[model samples]
Target: MLTISAKEMKDVLYELFKKYEFTESKANLLAEVFTQNTLYGVNSHGINRVPYFIETVKKGIVKVNEEAKKIEAFGNIERWDGNQGPGIINAVTCTNRAIALAKKDGMGLVALRNTNHWMRGGYYGWQAAKENCIAILFTNTQPNMPAWGGKESRIGNNPFVVSIPRKEGHIVLDMALSQFSFGKINNYKLKGEQLPYHGGWDEDHKLSKNPENILKTEQGLPIGYWKGSAFSIVLDMLATLLSAGNSTYKIGLKEHETAISQVYLCIYPEIFHDQDLQHTLINEIINYTHDVTPSEKGERTYYPGERAANAEKHNSKNGMKVNKEIWQKVLSLL
Candidate 1:
């Protein structure tokens, strides 16, 4: 592992993105987004994904200098075509647009079609929450995870994220329908550690904690067996319906995962509830959870986003620890 300050890492990445011909503002934003993810301990969607992003852009799977174009609008709901733009930038733009609409109408929904992979879905959640809005964001990926009771890959993992505002720290839940993402499995494999639970099935049709076996089979377990699978199906339907974008089924046909769909919703809770009432209610609920007795000694309690906020603080102060090989790979780009 290599430890580099957040500023240094982001600056290097910014230079690399600029070298790729991204505009200064876009390059800077994307670099900071990646750096922030690492600082929050979300390495799978952060620096680890950078190499692939470059390759995709180089191959024209992801467009350069393209902007999301608004396609339709009705009341507080709007649809945009990504024009195959950079995912991180497109997601940020959509989230901000949602925030703007929520500021006016008390709520907003934006569905984006033909976008590249957004890298980290939670970034947009945090983006909205930071602006004092409650946000929900999700995206459909390539058909990678298999449906429950099936050995063949027939469903998308479908990352989902939700965030709520709070005085102490925002509450965020970032999850994939699948028990583990392939990027996460590769991370664990690199570390030579077994998954804490059965993440997927092996070719022998047995549940396994071994990342290698799970990767080979591409038979990742859903979060709750059939329930998560059903949830994924519904999410895909909604994404396709709202964005008029390609579904996982269609995306799978091209044997590529570009031109994905995403949805962002933002609510101005303060418009309906006063600040005091909002803070009091959120505090009471969080306090109740924190007051619970730990089942084991030395166990600590945390609310959503609490651990990640702490990680950001610690990493920003000390430095982010990154995979040495990955850092070298990125450095070679310079």
Candidate 2:
């Protein structure tokens, strides 16, 4: 483990992306997106994934210069083709587009097709919340987790995010359908630590907390067992249908994980109610949640995004903690 300042990480990433032929503006955006995600304590999708992203570019899975284009539009809903662009750029564009439409029409839906991984889904949620908009975002990945009661990977973990704006801090829920994401499992393995609970089955077909075993078996457990499996299926269906793009099964046929679907939905609160009243209602709910008794003494309850917000503040003042090897790898790219 090592502490690296945000500026250092961003500078190196910017240089690396520029070397990969991204325009100066695009490189800067990529640097900010990746660095901000790391500062928000999602290193798995931030610095940890940079090497993989670069590899995807090298393999032509992510086309560096391609940009998303509007394909169709009806009412406040629109469909766009990513043109196999960098996922972070495509996702940011769609998020901003949805926010713009929602501001004008109370709500907006942007269905995006052929995008690669969007890194941290929470980034877009926070983006919308910062603009005083509520957002729900969804993206389907390659078939990486097994459906309940079935062996072998059959369903995508399918990241989901919901965010509400608040004066104090945004209320955000960002989660994968799996009991544990592969990134998290890999992190624990890197630290030589076991998962706190059973995360998946081992080759012997029994629940295990061992990260190595879970990674080997590729049998990550669903969040609520059968319920999560069903949720993953429906979210994938919705993304595919809305974007008119590849579903999990179709993505599995590709040489690698690419050309996936995503949906960004945004709602403007001021259009529905008084902004001040909306803030009060949000604060009341969050305060009520915080007022609950802690399950353990000396522990405090927190809302969904509170910890991440705190992390961002703390990491900005103090350097972010990053894996030494991963940081070195990123530096080597420079």
Candidate 3:
């Protein structure tokens, strides 16, 4: 295991990205996003995945300098095409644009089509929440899990994120339809550890914590069995139809996952209600939730994004724990 300070991580990765032909500004943005994810303890989507991301660029799956193009504008809602650009940049651009529209019109809806994987979907949630706006977003991926009863992979996990601003801390929920993300499973597999919960089924069709078995069988369970299966289908529908882009079914036909669809929504609470009233309500809701008795003796309940914020603070102070192998791979990039 190894650890690196956030400043070093960002500076090193920024230069590495520039070596790959990314513009200095774009490289800086990408490096910051990746570093932020690591700082927040989401290594599955952070520095841990940078090697593969760079490989995708080398393979031409992600156009290094491509920028998204606006397709149409309707009131506060707009559509964009990613043009196979870096997903993180496209998503950030759309998120900022959504917030800008909300600032002007009280709300904004942006749909992006033909985009690549956005990496950490929750990044945008935090992005909007920091601006004191409500945000909701989701993206469809290639078919990686089965639809409900059928054994064949028919739908994507479809990550979803929602963020609400609060004086104490932003409330952010980042989740997938599945009980565990493939990235989580891969991390467990790498560490040779068992999942604390039943994550998926084995090749023999029995529930298992062995990540390798789940990966081989591709039997990752949904959040609520059938319910998550159905929810994923609905999210996929919205992303595809709203963005006028590739559906999960069509993405399954591709050689690689690209041209995915995503949606970004932002609402300015000050426009709809007084800031004081919003804070009061937020406090009331949080306090009531906190009053609930703990099911575990040592565990305290935290709002979705609270843990992430806490992790960021801790990692920032102590430096980030990183897999030594992945760290070595990243160094080789330089």
RMSD (Å) of each candidate, 1 decimal? 1.1, 1.0, 1.1
lDDT of 2 by residue, 210-296 (tens): 999999987889999999999999999999999999999999888899999999999998896688888788888878988888999
Model 1, CA-based lDDT: 0.91
For model 3, state the Cα shift of residue 148 in Å: 1.1
Give the count of colliding residue pairs in each prediction. 0, 0, 0
Ranking by lDDT: 2, 3, 1
Query: Clashes in model 2: which pairs?
Result: none
Candidate 3 residue runs with Cα over 4 Å from true position: none
Error of 2 at 232 (Å): 0.4
TM-score result, candidate 2: 0.98
Question: What's the CA error at residue 20 for candidate 2, in Å?
Answer: 0.8
lDDT (tens digit, per residue) of candidate 3 on 174-265: 99888998888888987989988998778777788888998887677888989999999999999998899999999888888998999999
lDDT of 2: 0.93
TM-score against truth, every candidate: 0.97, 0.98, 0.98
Overall lDDT per candidate, in order of appearance: 0.91, 0.93, 0.91
